[model samples]
Target: MVSSSLFNRASKVFPGGVNSPVRYYTPEPIYFARAKGTKLLDEEGKEYLDFSMGFGAVFTGYANSDILDTQMEIFANPVPEGVVNEKEIILGEMINEAVPSMEMMRFTNSGTEATMHAIRLARAFTGRDIIVKMNGGFHGAHDYVLIGAGSGAATFGTPTSPGIPEEIGKTVLVGEFNHRESLEQIFEKHGNNIAAVIVEPIMGNMGVILPEPCFLEFLRDITEAHGALLIFDEVITGFRFRYGAYQDMIGIRPDLTTMGKIIGGGLPVGVFGGREEIMKNISPQGKVYQSGTFSANPYTMATGIATLEYLKKIDYQSTIRLACWIEDKLKPYEDMGLKVNRAYNMFTPFFNQQRVWDYPSAVASDSLKFMTFFRGLLKHGIYLSPGQFETSFVGPAHSPESVEMAAFKMVYTLENEMNESGNA
Candidate 1:
């Protein structure tokens, strides 16, 4: 009732009563009054166990004290001088050390800007016009990166949103994730003109689909042979699994890396970096120009530094162990026709017979059934990402008791769905 009242009033000014498209859904979206650790309290004082983790952005947990303290200090001295600052320099150094591919780096206010600049940098460096992106691999909102986007775009069944000029979409080619032959065919058709092959190394946008054996290695080999830059968009994966980027874990260095979400330390931020030779093209160095007023705000920089420093101290294997425990609980549902795809601290359970590996297979999942399951889970005090295509994140804040509670809630919800369908 409280959420309904707020949604109705907010809808007058904002479309769908929410700032972000993904937050809106049927009935009404719950408005959280406050959140801490792994728990969120709604407007009506009802508490829910959070598994979304702010769409995998709050890796260090909600309202992390260390980050908040640093953020407060920066707020005391709000200086909007020129872009370059001490905090920015330190954060850049931190990023480069974590991701070796980032020989040099630049910061942006959001993931969309970082991705947009990455594409432009690739084009400038390679002197090519075409950009190849994996099907359902979401980069950002820019015209060049929007083609065949997943996440909310795929959830709404609109891969390429309207208003993006047809000519703009033409320069972007879509390749299948985890399918080597499909990429080979695309290369055969337009390899010469391609500038870069952009991808989410772990494919978080289309749930938690992972690369098959030698799939990443295949990407590295093919892109190198074709003389195209490989851009790993680790916006969701970066800092979520390990203290650094996922590319280092894969052992395949990308030419350029776009990162966001966790690196922001629960603030809004994005960063793109690459080899020094290729990065020199951006303004003040080369012809290609990119600038932003809030590119490296001191607040975001300080918080990010604290977040990464704290993450470095954390034992990532512990979080993964908890994720595995949760997955083990979901394994029983497999016999009842559910498929669970997992990678590190992320997982997605599909209502289909097959394991989802690509965009097409991901879309084949039963959304209606997922929606019912989602609503049921919410009633049981478990909050999940609303869309079936979005991946659920497990954080270090999720205690053993929290994992056990989530497992119980999940099983009970699944049983409810089965009973309602007369399959129990």
Candidate 2:
């Protein structure tokens, strides 16, 4: 009744009773009144083990004292806009040190703006128009990325949304994530006019789909061969598995890269950068123009640096160990003929028996049964994203007790499912 009443009031104001389309479920989205380390207290006073983790933005956990203190200090002496802030340079230096491919960078208010700018830079630098994106890759909500979008768009069955003009939509080409021939076919046809191929190196929006062997390497070589820039949208994967960008570990350096989520330290922020020659195309330096009022403001700069500093000292290996342990426990489910795709600290359990490697196969996973699985987790006080296409994250803050409780709940739920199907 608490969340229901809140939804009733919210629906009158916000569309679908939520600000974000992904936040809305069938009955209503539950409201979390407060959050702490690895937990969310709902409007009804029920506490949930938060597996969603702020859509992968929260790496250091909720209400982190270091980040909060940084924010407070910045608030005490407010940051100025329309002028150069020293903290932006400091943050930029830290990011460049971590991800060496970004020789120069620019900040934006959101990943949408970052990707938009990156695409524009690519087009200007290469003197081309058409861009390529993975079929299920979600760069952001902008018109260039919304075509065949995954996550919320895939969950709602509207891969391509309305309102994007045909002229704009036709320029963006879509190809499968792990499928090689699909991209080869696209490049074979539109090689000359293709400005860039933007991809998520490791797909996050479509439930942690991993890139196949040499898939990323192929993108780099092919884009170079066709005189097109390769952009890696590491918005979700920036620091999910390591201290640096995933591309660093994978040994692939993109021409341009867009980063968000963990880099912002839970603030509204985004950054895009690459080789100096390419990034030079962004305004005041080159023809492509980009400017934002809130981009790299002192507040975000301070907290972002603080978070990255904290992450440097933390052990990411701990998260990998914990995630692998959970995967080991869930491995029995695969023996029982179910699919659970995982990569490091991120994973998703599909409700179908078939494998999911691309957008079409991912879409085929049973959404209704996944919702049932979602409700079962909710009953046991585990909160994951409601959409099947979204990835569930595990952070450094998660405790053994929470994992035990969650594991028990998962096995119990699946046992009930098998019984229902007369396979127990």
Candidate 3:
């Protein structure tokens, strides 16, 4: 049995015994001593091939030497007085160059702050009151973005949290993912009132549901027609799916885009940016205001610069190829009654009879079976995201050999689950 001493101590001081609700598991989270590359070594010295990948932030890998060196360099020579750090300047320039839609970018400490500021900018620019978000999509923990939050929110069975005032929740309209009709319904009713429509082009929070054909185009069309800004919350899909934003992959240009995870290079960072016209609405340029003391802290900028520079040199196609291989390897499991699926490097093996397209379907999956399979995989030295709604990430750290090992463990875990249930 794992020790509850750490968790027990944590519960006394921290809510739910974890700093982040998503990190909390049924029994308790495993305390890790350290992580290197694709592997995590727990406090008890148990090793597991980690697929969680810091919630898809550590795209380059854990403890990357290049990033560490850059971080050290930043530490050695603090920010020069009256001189902006070259790393932040370079990162901003690189992002603007790579994603043409983002003419000006402002860094934040996390995705929540990015979305919060983006929404504020949209409202200020458009002079509108309402914000539309997908029913199961998660933007971040802020009251405005947390409407119909997924992951821990779904697990708790409260689509919208209780602490938020009724006035705040009323402004957040929820639409269904992949269903343009639902969006149209919401838009037709309150199109003029909406300041912005924020969406995850590839729905990562709700189990990797890809947008239906022309769904993104419909969003662009409707939002444009209604004079509402379309904000693509690419916190998960920004750099992971492709070199630029996933919006580029789908051939749609969002008025504003919020990015986190990989952009931070495993450090705490978030960014929101878009056309110069809308961006000017923020801070010194316009009436709308947003700021953070640690927004562009030199350490995070250094790590982000190193990570993006390294990413520019990587063969993204090769990483996608490895993901495709893992997908192919798991295809057989679907025939065995497991609902295995993949979208980019995010993959899931759902123990359900039907496909999961939205929050309802996603929650209908067999959580108990997933829990069993999760324990089985853990026993076999493979780590997976603890919840059914969360996606299992594959990163640059996971090589073909490491993926093959994980595949074997997954198959064995499924087989064991089937056996115990007398379905094998």
What TM-score against the true fold does each predicted structure earn? 0.95, 0.95, 0.94
Ten residues in sequence with the least summed lDDT for candidate 3: 149-158
lDDT of candidates 1 onward, in order: 0.85, 0.85, 0.82
Over 237-322, each residue of candidate 1 has an lDDT whose tens digit, in order, gives 88888878888887999999999989888898999999999999998888888998878888888889999999988889988988
Show where candidate 1 strays beyond 4 Å.
Answer: 79-82, 149-159, 418-424
Model 3: pairs clashing at backbone N, Cα or C within 3 Å: none
Candidate 2, residues 1-424, lDDT tens digits: the string is 8889999999999988888898888777788899998899998899999889889898789988878898898999887876898999999999999999999999998999999999989998988988888887999999888876323311211237778776676677777788888778788888899999999988888787888899999999999999999999999989778898999998999999999989988898899999999988788988789999889988889989999988888888887777676677777887565577888888888766777777888888877767777877787798887778988888888877787778777888777754432111
- lDDT digits (tens) for residues 137-223 of candidate 3: 888898887666324211211237789776676677877777777778788878898999999888887566777688889999999
| lDDT of model 3 at position 352 | 78
Question: In lDDT terms, how accurate is model 1?
Answer: 0.85
On a 0 to 1 TM-score scale, where does candidate 1 land against the true structure? 0.95
lDDT of model 3, residue 117:
95
RMSD of each: 3.4, 3.7, 3.6
